[model samples]
Target: MIKVAFVFGFRNENWLGGINYYRNLISAIKSLPDRKIDPVILIGTRGSEDLLRDFPQLEVVKTTLLDRRHPSWFFRKLLYRISGRDIVFEKFLIKNGVSVLSHHHPLGKRARVPVMGWIPDFQHKHLPELFSEIELKSRDKWYGEIASQCSRIIVSSDHARKDLEKYFQVEARRISVLKFVVDYPKDLDLLDRAALEEKFSFEGGYFHLPNQFWQHKNHEIVVDALKILKDKGQKVVVLATGNTVDYRKKDHFNWLCKKIEEAGVADGFRILGVVSYGDLVSLMVHSAAVINPSRFEGWSTTVEEAKTLDKPVILSRIEVHQEQAPKNALYFDPKNASELADCISKALLCDTRGKGGGFPLNDLAVSNNFAQRIAFANEFQEAVLAAAYPQEKVHSPML
Candidate 1:
């Protein structure tokens, strides 16, 4: 089996999407019929034990070199700066028998193992106003290095692949598009939707907006849409769940609250900040429809989750969202509140409660999920093989 190492350096709750991506990817690989790849997680001493518990099936190697707070991490950085080589990290991967490193920062050109660098999106390039000058420079530098140094580069969407080609001038052959898939729990039927609704103190059908409170997420449009609905004497409840804070925009959450209050739709807009994974899934399953009003995305996890559950989605008309092409999605301009309000109105008329009422798992749903997992694993494995064996021509089905 080809052992591929996934680096887990994120410790903050705000990066729940990142954590879920790795978990779902590993689970997909393990589900393959032949199972030619063995996925391992490389975490730090400061990493969450909960994260370790989430991946009990995989081998986890904890090392001080990954922990930013540890002195060894600083020493490694100094050594890299002095010699332009990541000797400690390279040695760690070699000792652990890692054939390829995926989805981590590029380890310079001189690294021993094959590295597959992942650039989720070019959000900084498109939404430059949301980022500071320092962040813009850092992303450009990092992405540029990944394009030039890494043996293979993985982008989440073709939209991102275009961005990489346009902005970084990288050859199309060097980039691989691997759209990640969601792996829902098998025991979803055990989650009591009614009890969760009672716990959160909400009534009947509601729309779910589960994106983080980042400025680029464009939550102001949702607030405005709620006000438009209220003006028409229609009360629509939107249950928003995510981390309330955006480190880049410290006051973004408060600003959104103020906007909701000013629009007099505070009664209809409920912010349930940072819910547990099970509760989040239950809420999505039980909602009238899932909504993603983001102005930009690499590949939307919310859209994928809603699709896997056969739930309808009301999404913004972004290029990536169009590429995703969910089954029952209503697209609206992210900047137009009236358009989103119309989409929400139409979504409210559809009755999706039955899908989540008892969480029944039909044969069709199981088959579709199995097929999606296999496709994701096959594409990811192809990317790994291409990176590991650069001389051999590995044809990706995605390309």
Candidate 2:
């Protein structure tokens, strides 16, 4: 059995993106047979308790060093300078004879074990403003260095791989493209659809955009389209769901709320704070379409989940979204409000389908193929052994 670590930074339990990524990846990785894996999960002092309590499988390592603010994560910067924490983490991995396959940053750069780095997207290089100036520089430097140092790199979409190859200069062969899919969209066949709507108290005729109110998510454009729909006498409601307490993002959300009120569509749009996993699934099923207006994405699980439910999608015409989305989705330009409004109008004209999807549909859709992720993990184990004990003949970890 070969051990592997799942290294990540700070995350909120309620945040869908970070937590879901970890949960799905862990679920898949742990399925590897006879594997001795220590999914070494790292989080900030502030965010540690929630994940630790929730995920009993992880080997949690807490650090107060990184702040989840703009470009100035002083703790993370200190990570590069004070290598002891990583060294200690490394010692733990080395002692356990584990390989490290990272979901994110800093771990791969500091790793003595063979590191498989996960690069979600190269959006920092493409759109600098979404990230604070300090964050852009720091992330670029750190990720670029780690991409070069790690044994292999994983990206969620082909667009990301292209971007990494072009900007980070990593060879194409080193980067593997994996599309992300949600685990339980099918199992979310809760009760009959009518029963779910009644249980969740959902009235229907709404759309779901299950992304946080980040600037790049292009939520304002969504709001703009809502306004146009109201003017056209269309009774459309947009149920916006995400974390409301982000340190830097509260004001934007507040402003968006004010915009909704001013546009007289306040009654139509609901900004739900945080919701349970079941309610979220209910929201997806009842909604007409899953709308994503992201300025950029490595790959979006929202649309993927929507597809698995056989629901139609109305999305921004971004390369990454196009890569994962079905060919029949209603498309719009991410930046232009007029284009988005037109797409919304078009989507309203269509029918929403909720048919079942492909076989064993709940498999690894992100960062790996199902069986290959297991195979590569064993290969990673072998790499670490060959590095550690050069003289002995290398034995397969699969046995």
> How accurate locally, in lDDT, is each candidate?
0.86, 0.65
Q: List the residue pairs that clash in candidate 1.
A: none
* lDDT of model 1, residue 300: 95
Compared with the true structure, the alpha-carbon lDDT of candidate 2 equals: 0.65
Q: Write the per-residue lDDT of candidate 1 for residues 1-399, one digit (tens) a residue.
A: 889999888787777788788878888888877756789888898788685445438788899999885899999999889888788898889999999999877777778898999999999999899899999999999999899898889999999999999998999888889999898755444357668777899777788899989899899999999999999998899899998889998998899899989999888999999988888888887788899999999999999888888888999999999999999999999999999999998887676453333453467977888888889988888889888888997654531
Clashes of each: 0, 3
How well does each candidate superpose onto the true structure, as a TM-score?
A: 0.96, 0.76
Q: Cα miss at 47, model 2 (Å)?
A: 6.3
lDDT tens digits by residue: candidate 2, 235-263:
77777777765454558777877887887
Q: What is the lDDT of residue 216 in candidate 1?
A: 91
Alpha-carbon runs more than 4 Å astray in model 2 = 8-11, 31-85, 104-111, 185-202, 246-250, 352-399
Pairs that clash in candidate 2? 65-75, 71-135, 179-365
